[model samples]
Target: MSLVDLSWRNVRRNFRLYTIYFISMLVGVVIYFTFSSLMYNEDVVTAIQNKDNYGKIIFIASIIVFLFIVFFILYANSFFMKQRKKEFGMYLLYGMKERQVATMVFFETLFLSAISVSSGILIGGFLSKFFGMVLMNLMNYNDDISFAFPQEAIISTILLFTLLIGIITIQSYLNVRRVQLVELFHAKEKMDKPLKFSMPFAILSILLIVMSYYTITIAGDTNIWNDYFKEALIATTVSLIVGTYLFFRQFSGWVLQKMSQSKNYFKGNKMLWVSSLRFSIRGNTVNFTFNSLISAIVIFAVGFIAVDYAMKGEVVKKEFPNHFAFSTQDDETQKHIDKMMNESHPIIGHETITGIQTEKISNRKTFFSYPEYYTEEFYLFPESQLNAIVDLRGVGEKVDVEGVEAIVLTRGIDEPTKYESHQPEITVLDDNTFHVVEKIRYPLLSIPTNPGGDTGPQPSVLVISDEAFEHVKENRTLSSFEIYQIKDPKTSNDVSRKIYDIVMKTEGAYYSAYIDMYSIDTESSSLILFSVAFFAVIALFALGSVIYFKQLREATEEREHYAILRKIGVGDKEIKRIIRKQLLFVFLPPLILGLLHSWYLLYYTVILVIKDLPSLTTIIFSVMGLYVLTYLIFYVSSTSIYYKIINEKNRR
Candidate 1:
């Protein structure tokens, strides 16, 4: 038979062994292709105002995904090559030339890569449309999306995978040529030892991870956060990654060693299995730690996106209960805005609210001496805001802040502690002295605030009575806002655009007065949410596939070990039990750790965004529950395949 024909036949013959590998590769390709489709989509590009920035982000993220895929493929191929060593050895023993055998590996790789690339592109083409629908939902947008065949994305996928196939082919050729005949025959039986590290280093690894978490939590409390937020982010990010790597590399293996050392723990199948697990060339500490880290990242990425997207909906509902808010000085401007909005949207009703804002004499005073680094500003709403606005919002109820009392509106877990000391005293505008009633969060309205002082609006808003507001109105500049409730929600964009044109093109429109809470139509918000979500999903699938295939690839090497155990008087039942335990041990660490990591992050996100956990807790748990089910499936499938391989000899 021709070498190419033989290789093709071998691929067909080993379809079972190649299934998971093929599936994962296909998934990776689909992810890349789908993303490419979005990246090159013209309609989407023109629609989003932040299109250029999004393109830059996609460019960077795509490179990351590409490099990651290459590494994953190479790593997976290494395990496959190990499994093929015996086959290669037998071929050489039967008088096949090394170059001919290597040529076979090359052909096999090329054929498989072609199948993966082609099928992935075909499937990706169909999925991209469905994905568009999903994106619109996630973004809370109401725009119709038509599916267009993405030629650029298709070409990109083809070229990328084709190049990978070429690289794999060359790698296979080199591997087969260098294979030592004796070593090839002995490869499966050989074991690999975990890397040795000192106790101090292990301790240091734990310390590093703790310190990294501390750095992230303490960032807001530091004076330098305003000036060095970007630097702090970079530093914290590096620390988190390096610390995780170090912990897994040095500390996790040490933990397993300690578990083994326990006299009571190591017995019967446990002793044998634990020893086997710790000593296996395939399940070495490095791979275990690396895969765990990958799984953790998958959890974090997915959770981050889920919470972000979910909270955005909450933000719009709570923060922007009204359709549009236009703050204008001229009553003429108000008329123009009203007409423009009415032309686009049938107005159900509108509210003209007046409030006092002070550029000067609007500072909040703290009672206690503290660090020099607190900048989440507290703003005032006139007493009329409580009876008129806050009453409508139904959040911060009138608390009888008659003369000497003020309530600090707490957002979430993070807000109550903004002050360094407890029971902070506040002197509003330094003239109205009020003892803190209690710090509480009331999401009465969603007005965008710049957290840092770089932006004028403060995050915290307090409500006083109309009497108190009227007293202070003359002291500060009076501003008015016309908040309109529109009947047709989908027409928000049209209304916003008309108002923008009026404010921009019309003569004598004040530069400072502007519209907000309406400018963010569903389409723009949906785009932002879906874009982040898509990146998270792509990362998650890629990482999950890698870990699953990594485990599956090792099953071939495990078969011989099970055979030896059965020969040494271990019953089939006992072997099966041992295998279950072994797999559970390997699976749980990464999965559990990743969940905890994601949980902490999600909580942090809630504090900043929605601030209330009860609102999003169900959704958060549901996403996590889905992940657990998916990862559990991987574990079960891997174990079943491994078990079947170990006992397949009995069937014969």
Candidate 2:
């Protein structure tokens, strides 16, 4: 048979073993095609106001997907090449020329790549419809949805897979050329002792890790200056990655050595287990490190997406607590507005704070704040207050605002303590006299105050008195209005429409003041929730499948070792125990690190999304729960596959 036919038959016979790699490539293609389809969809094109920007988002997503595909293909292809070294050697020993052998290798890769890519694209085309439907549902795009195949996406997929396959073919050809026949034959037998690092390097790695953590913490808490803080975070992340890789490399050896010194070294299979694990880690340290980083990022991304979705619900509730909160510039629409409000919801006790705006042309400055802007002195408003605002128009008795020019603190304000200090500065305007008042703590009602810098509006200390309001409006006209909170939050939209109609009827005298009820749209929040859940499922599946398959490939090489141990009178139970231990060592560290990083990331991300982070207990428990469930599944699946391989080898 020709080399190409030989390679093809071998692939078919070993299809089960290669299925995982093929599936991964298929998934990458599917994701790429799905995203590309979304980007090129005519419906999406029409929906977005800024089509160019939408196109850019597509391009960016495509680029990210493409890079990931390249990395995954290259990594998996390396393993494939390693697995086939013996075959390559056999071909060379049969008197095949190196150039012919290289050509055969290239042809084999091209055949496999072509098959996988073509299947992926076809499957992806079908999946694109499903994905589009899901995305549309998540975004609340409910207007007459129909899936149409985008020619652009098809073309993009073809080009992308063509490039990927060409690269893999070249790499296979080069690898064949580089390896001598003897080297290829002995590739499976070439085992090197694990490298040991001095204590100083281990210490340095730990130090770097510590520094990275410290830097990230500082970055998280730094004042919201754009340039400096961004650079610091980027630097910290890079340092953390490098340090983490070095630590894994040296730490595995150090751990094995320490275990060897222990009494447990002679008990059971502790020594074997430790040695195997250390070898596995040392053998694939770079791969392990990169995998860890990828896992960490994936965890962080999933957590952020989840928390962001949850917070969107909270945002909507806070922004529109009651139905039809309205204000108007003119009194002519008052009766009509009241009628609309009454029709929309059962009116509870309605109250309005009226004030005239005058420009304080002398020395006063306008300042505002939200929960996020507060120092430790400003306690976030109690949930009860938010509930009351939503359900009952009664401001919870806990909030007390005093005189005109007094700070209308939304929540309680305490003096700054040692741990938390405030940067309270007063700026004098050229025309108006401004006074610093008690800071307010309200549920975030708008875009979160920029936490990274002091660029946006600070929390407001409401100067409640009409006199104080007037003092700040020198050149500005005094505009008077009322904010009415209604009994039913859901009816707020209907009431708003009624008020708009009234204001339209009143023409010149009544300008319908804009009250953003975007937050009241539960659909948006629901969509966000769906998107998070979908992506989380995808990420976990991808991570588990990739890791499981990679480990399975390696298991083939270790099958002989396990069989030899069995022949040497090691009990099957002991072998299994060793497998478990090795698996634990291989799997546990990345999870621990990823979870730790994810927890911290989620904590601050929550702070960014909502004014207050979730309770520490809640955050910790939720994260731990996710970790245990997913990790356990991964562990069980991986161990089962490993043991199965060993058992099969023993039988042979």
Instruction: Report the lDDT tens digits of candidate 1 across residue range 211-276.
Output: 766765664566655788788778766766666666666666666677678986647777766766
Tens digit of per-residue lDDT, candidate 2, span 76-147 = 777778878888888888888777877776676666667776787777767767776765555445434356
Worst 10 residues of 1 by lDDT: 449-458
- TM-score of every prediction relative to native: 0.71, 0.70
Runs of candidate 2 with Cα error greater than 4 angstroms are 1-7, 40-54, 95-149, 197-243, 301-363, 366-550, 569-574, 600-633, 647-652
Off by over 4 Å in 1: 40-49, 91-100, 146-148, 193-268, 281-283, 301-322, 325-344, 352-481, 488-491, 510-550, 564-573, 597-627
Q: Highest TM-score: which candidate? A: 1
Candidate 1: C-alpha lDDT: 0.62
Question: How well does candidate 1 score on lDDT at residue 116?
Answer: 90
